[model samples]
Target chain A: LAKTTQPISMDSYEGQEVNITCSHNNIATNDYITWYQQFPSQGPRFIIQGYKTKVTNEVASLFIPADRKSSTLSLPRVSLSDTAVYYCLVVTNNQGGKLIFGQGTELSVKP
Target chain B: DTAVSQTPKYLVTQMGNDKSIKCEQNLGHDTMYWYKQDSKKFLKIMFSYNNKELIINETVPNRFSPKSPDKAHLNLHINSLELGDSAVYFCASSQGTVVTTIYFGEGSWLTVV
Candidate 1:
């Protein structure tokens, strides 16, 4: 399993783009970068998953560099509802769904 | 329709008592899991089952045993619960061993007094 590092918290205002980066230096070849959003008292929701390059979805976008050592999650035009803890995980496909979560970046979206 | 659902969203019990949390997934997924989130907000995997067979068992306590009667159902039973066992337990599921994405259910808040 690959260990990941990310910021502890971030502050952003509404309508501003926010980017949270995660570093996985020992990422394996089969590892995939996955981002999840978690609200208070709720389950974490999957935002996006990427292998390399860039991947975008309706909720967020994930950018992985060519080296695959780090990745970024971009939330466009944030809102107060987007204030939540975002987890970046290095998911191994063959690990029987063991997603080791790191200390997620707590994003507080201001008014 | 809800994909993954767990019962007793909140559980309050005394120490040394046994309790169970039931979970069912309507997504027809083959793999199911149980994760524990401590008060410090660290999420850790406890168990994983595929087609009702045990696959991954972390260093969880022996008192914490997981039962999966079928592919869609996974239940967690804790014996002699302790105060330190208090945390949010999440039930999740995926379609295969190769995890593309795992869906989580609203956690079951367990408080052991």
Candidate 2:
């Protein structure tokens, strides 16, 4: 499993775009980078995922460079409700593909 | 309807006692997982069952056992719980290994005093 590193915390005001980057230097070709958003007292929710290049969803967008060593999750038009911990995970294609969640970046969206 | 649900959203017990948390998924998925979130809010995978077969068992303590009678239900049993065992446990499900999305249950907050 590849360990991921992300910012400890970040603050952004409403209507602004926020980008959180994750670094996984040892990420493998078969590994897929996925991001999850978690709020207090609730389970984490899937935001977006990408194997390479870019992938966009109704919620967020994911961008992966050629090296695949890092990925950035871009959340547009942030709101106070978007305040949550964002986790960057590198998942392998194995039988028991476990998602290793890092400490996650605490994103504080202020109004 | 709730896709994934865990019973007794909150569980409070004393140390050395045995407790069980039940999880069920209505998504008709074949895989289920148990994750523990520590005080620091770090999520760690504990056990995963695919098609009722034990697939992933992390280095979790033996005292923490997960049983899946079928594809839709997975239960976690903790024997001799300790103070450190107090944390929120989450149950999640996915279609298969390659699928990127994993739906998670609200969570079960376990407090061991």
Candidate 3:
């Protein structure tokens, strides 16, 4: 299991782009970076995932450098509904999908 | 239509009581997991089961027991619950043992009074 580090909190205005970076210096060869969005009183939802370079989805985008030591989650055109805690997880494929979540980045989208 | 679901959305029980949270996934997933989120909203993995076999068990207490009758169902039973046990328990599942995306249920909020 690889440990991940991310910002504790971030503030963004509506219609702006928000990027949250996560650092996993000890990322293993089989590790993949995944981002999840959690809203109050709801379960965490999958946003995006990436192994290297950039991966884009309907909701968000994930960028990973060649070193695989760090990754960034980018949310475009934020809205108030985007205010939630985002978790970045570095997981090994053979771990049977066991995810260790850290103190996620609390993103507050203002009006 | 509700890929992953858990029973007893809210449970308020007295200390030392026993309770169980039932979960089922209709996604045809082979792996299921149990996670606990504290008040501070930090999620921790408690257990993982793949194909009805236990694959990962974190340092959770003996009071917390998990059972998976089949690949689609996993239940968590807690005995002699303490005040510190007050947290939200979430049941999740993934397609297989690989790093496929994991889906989570709404969560069972347990309050030990």
Which docking class does model 1 fall in? Answer: high
lDDT of 1 by residue, B31-103 (tens): 9999999998999999999999999999899999999999999999999999999999999999988886999
Candidate 2: C-alpha lDDT: 0.92
lDDT by residue for model 3 (B8-108), tens? 99999999999999999999999999999999999988999999999999999999999999999999999999999999999999988886589999999
Q: Candidate 2 chain B: worst 10 consecutive residues by lDDT?
A: B94-103
- What digit string (tens of lDDT, one per residue) describes model 2 on residues B1-113? 99999987999999999999999999999999999999999998899889999888889999999999999999999999999999999999999766668899999999999
lDDT of 2 by residue, A1-111 (tens): 789999999999999999999999999878889899999889999888889999998999999999999999999999999999999999876736478889999999987
lDDT of 3 by residue, A1-111 (tens): 789999999999999999999999999998889899999988899888889999998999899999999999999999999999999998777777778899999999999
After superposition, the stretches of candidate 2 with alpha carbons farther than 4 Å from their true spots are none
Clashing pairs in 2: none
Model 1 off-target regions past 4 Å? Answer: none
Question: Which residue pairs does candidate 1 place in steric collision?
Answer: none
What TM-score would each prediction reach against the true structure?
Answer: 0.98, 0.96, 0.96
